[model samples]
Target: MLEALAQNLVYGILIGALYGLAAVGLSLVFGVTKFLNVSHGELLMLGGYASFWLFALWKVDPFISLPAAIIFLLVAGVVFYKLLFGRMVKLAEGDKIQNTLLVGFGLSLILQNLALQFWTADTRSITTAYSGAVFSFAGVRFPLVRVASLVIAFVLIVALQLFLRRTYTGKALRATVENWEAATLMGIDIQRVYLLSFVMGAALAGVAGALVAVGYSIEPAMGMSWTLKSLVVMVLGGLGSITGTFVGGIILGVTESATGFFLSLTYREVVGLVLFLLVLVFRPQGLFGVKEG
Candidate 1:
């Protein structure tokens, strides 16, 4: 039992790290842009497809394709900003809460169906040199690819955190999140900031998708699950706090891992949903969110 538990914990943390990275991107988009990105999952899916195609066709390593997909999706995100998110933001004007939701949701559906049309409903994954290798540590075994994915995600998280904390753009983005009005008053190029931030967040989601494809499965419908799970982490960790998302991701991952071990695997999702609702009722501010009112 102890061995099984240890194995689960090790794997769970790795899985949670990747999940948290995806969730943090979502949080940043929602926190600063004040919009729900239903299409965010599609952004990830596209990246996954991009990476898989590169590997399956050109024999490119998944890791190498990961950044390639990011660069591609980053451009896609910028286009999405110019065509869709920007329009929604403008439509929101000052009272954007409801409008952003409706707009984003509609956009999500459109993007989802469009992907289905192009890619079909089949599931996909990429096999690599270390695809099935397992690592042993103190009588516990873990998947090597998963470990690598987690390490990559961790590095990306640290780099992003530092970027957000130390750079001029990072400070400017923080200003927008802390107070959009004041940010504009400071002559912070609101339009440019909005465009760049939205695209950057979308690009982050795309990168996550690429990393995930290396370890898991992807289908047209995968986006919805990713969106929901990331939302669970976002709500659990507190919306908009990058640090909180990391903590919340691990908690949710470990909870699911333990539940799967002690109970039916079919009920793992139910356990997660219940946890999400419990947090909603008990900790509306999330685990780390500051109370607004």
Candidate 2:
């Protein structure tokens, strides 16, 4: 029992880091653009497919293909915002939110169906030569790929944090997020900020997707579920708080691990929903979320 508990803890931490990365992307978009991106998971799906095709066809390593995936998704995100979300940004706040949600949902459905047509609903995975390599200490064994993914996630998160804190454009982004009108009056290019935010968010999702592809099976319909999960993580982390998102992901990872260990795999999702509901009821602002004006 003790050994099992130890194993689950390690698993939870590793998986939770990936969850944090995914949720951070959503939170970043929401924080800056106030767009509830329902199509975010599809970006992950695209990343998975990109990595898979690169590995299967060209024999490129998934890690090696990550930069290309990031760039592709970043460009795609900028185009999406410019073509779709940009037009609605001038609407009344409530109307803009509603429209963005609807548009995102429609985009998600379209992407999912397109993927189904192309990938045929069949599940796929990327299995490199060292995919099954493991590290063992005491009675615990950890997959090397998962460990690598966790490390990459942390590195990316730290890089993102630094970018948001130290760079000129990053400061401009924060200013825009705080008050677009004031930022515009101060000569900050609001359109550029929005484009950068959306692109960064999409790129983060792409990286997380690549990591996930290395460890899990990929399928056309796999994105929606991850989308929902990432949303839960976003809300739990308090909407726009990066630190909160990370903590929320860890909490979720631990909770899911405990549930799966004690009960059945089927009930693990239910517990996440329950946690989300409880947070909504007790603290709608989120665990670490601030009440933004």
Candidate 3:
């Protein structure tokens, strides 16, 4: 029983890393731009497809094809922001959130339909020669693909943290998140920061998608679920702290895993929602978020 529990815990941490990675993208965009891009999961879906095609056509390794996915999403982000989201950049906070939410919802529908039209509604996953390889330690099994994914996710999150803390542009982004008006007055280009944050968020989602394609499965209708997961982690981790948000993802993953193990697999999904509701009611600022004055 202990061994089985340990195995389940390992699996939970592995998937939780992905949850963190996906949520980070959404959190970053919302934190910096205050634009809740509801279409985040669709962007993630496209990323999975991008990696899938790269592998399907040229037999590219999913890990090796990660750059392609990132590039694809970055370009998509640019187009999305310039053509659609950019128009609402100057709106008041309330209007910006509302308009962007509606727009993002519409965009998600369009993307989902386009995917279904082009790719069909079938589920897809990447199965490499070594996909089944696993190592056991003290009676617990750890899948290599999932372990690699966790490493990659952690590295990316750390890289993002460093970029935000150490780079000039990243500092500008932080300043904007704190106060866009002040950032603008300080000669930071608000539009550019928004564009960069949105693009980066899309890229992160792409990475998460590619990982999912290799480790799990992808379909046209998977966007909403993933988006909700990200939202849950974002809220749990708090608003502005990347580290906190990543930890939140891990917590949700572990909770779901435990719930599935002790209760039933059917209860796994409900755990997140329950936690989300509890958090909202008791601590709207989130576990790591600062309470606004």
Q: In candidate 1, where is summed lDDT lowest over 10 consecutive residues? A: 88-97
lDDT of 3 by residue, 117-207 (tens): 9999999999999999999999999899999999999999999999999999999999999999999999999999999999999999999
> If the candidates were sorted by their lDDT against the true structure, best first, what order would they fall in?
3, 2, 1
Q: At residue 67, what lDDT does model 2 achieve?
A: 99
Query: Compared with the true structure, what per-residue lDDT tens digits does model 2 show for residues 1-293?
Result: 89998899889888888888888998888888888888899988888888888899999999899998899898889888888888887888799889999999998898899999987898899999999999998899899999999888888888888888999898888888788999899899887888888889899888888888888778888778778878888889896577789878888888899999999889988887898899899999999988876
Flag clash pairs in model 1.
none
Kindly provide the TM-score of model 1 when superposed on the true structure, using C-alpha atoms. Answer: 0.94
RMSD of each: 1.8, 1.3, 0.9
Better of 1 and 3 by lDDT: 3
Q: Whose lDDT is greatest here?
A: 3
The numbered model that scores best in TM-score is 3
lDDT of each: 0.83, 0.87, 0.95
Off by over 4 Å in 1: 91-95
| Pairs with steric clashes in candidate 2 | none
